[model samples]
Target: MASSMVAVGLALAAAGFAGRYAMQALKQVEPQMKQALKSFPKTAFGGGFYRGGFEPKMTKREASLVLGLSPTANKVKIREAHRKLMILNHPDRGKTHPDRGGSPYIAAKINEAKDLMDGQK
Candidate 1:
């Protein structure tokens, strides 16, 4: 009987130590995860951008491609393209209609296309 009691006590002690160690490890890792998330790029066009490398510079042709527009599309065409893409790509719209799989990257691309169009004006 005494041996069984001792064994139970040791098991409890081991479990307590393991739980404390796990809590400590979790506390150490949480901040690292948050920092990593915070350091993620603000704009990632279709998961194309990465860190510590050459940033891809989009030309008017590339921007048009992202917006699903023809290269010869005019300002009004670009605006319509941006509006249509934004309706499908905005994060909020995706959240509200989770079935459609809207992409924040597409929304950013739309914004980029609009900026390019404005710059040409």
Candidate 2:
């Protein structure tokens, strides 16, 4: 009877270990499956638009307005406009003045404008 009990106990331990290993394997596979799903191309048939390889389009007018400069403005004027706009739209100042709503977007737009204008020169 003691031998039978030992056998049963060993069997139970082995089963428990197998179960734990199976669970871990499943856990690892779940993430890989999720990653594969995410990497899959979005399809219109799946009720999703293709977001892959798409970039935001910017226009010269939008850039000039963002930097607080006229569209006809030159490189030197663009730089000056960006400087002035940055002073008002800086995120640090927005932190102190909660009404400004943390002007990071404006700051980014200003930087984009400067980059576009500088590129044109």
The predictions' CA RMSDs to the true structure, in order, are 11.3, 14.4
Task: Show model 2 residue runs off by greater than 4 Å.
Answer: 1-55, 100-102
Cα lDDT for residue 19, model 1?
100
The alpha-carbon deviation from the true structure for residue 93 of candidate 2, after best TM-score superposition, in angstroms, is 0.7
Clashing pairs in 1: none
Error of 2 at 105 (Å): 1.1
Candidate 2, residue 89: CA error in Å?
0.4
Measured with C-alpha atoms, the lDDT of residue 30 in candidate 2 is 100
- The local distance difference test score of model 1 is 0.74
**Residue 73, model 1, lDDT:** 73
lDDT of 1 at 12: 100
Tell me how many clashing residue pairs each candidate has: 0, 0
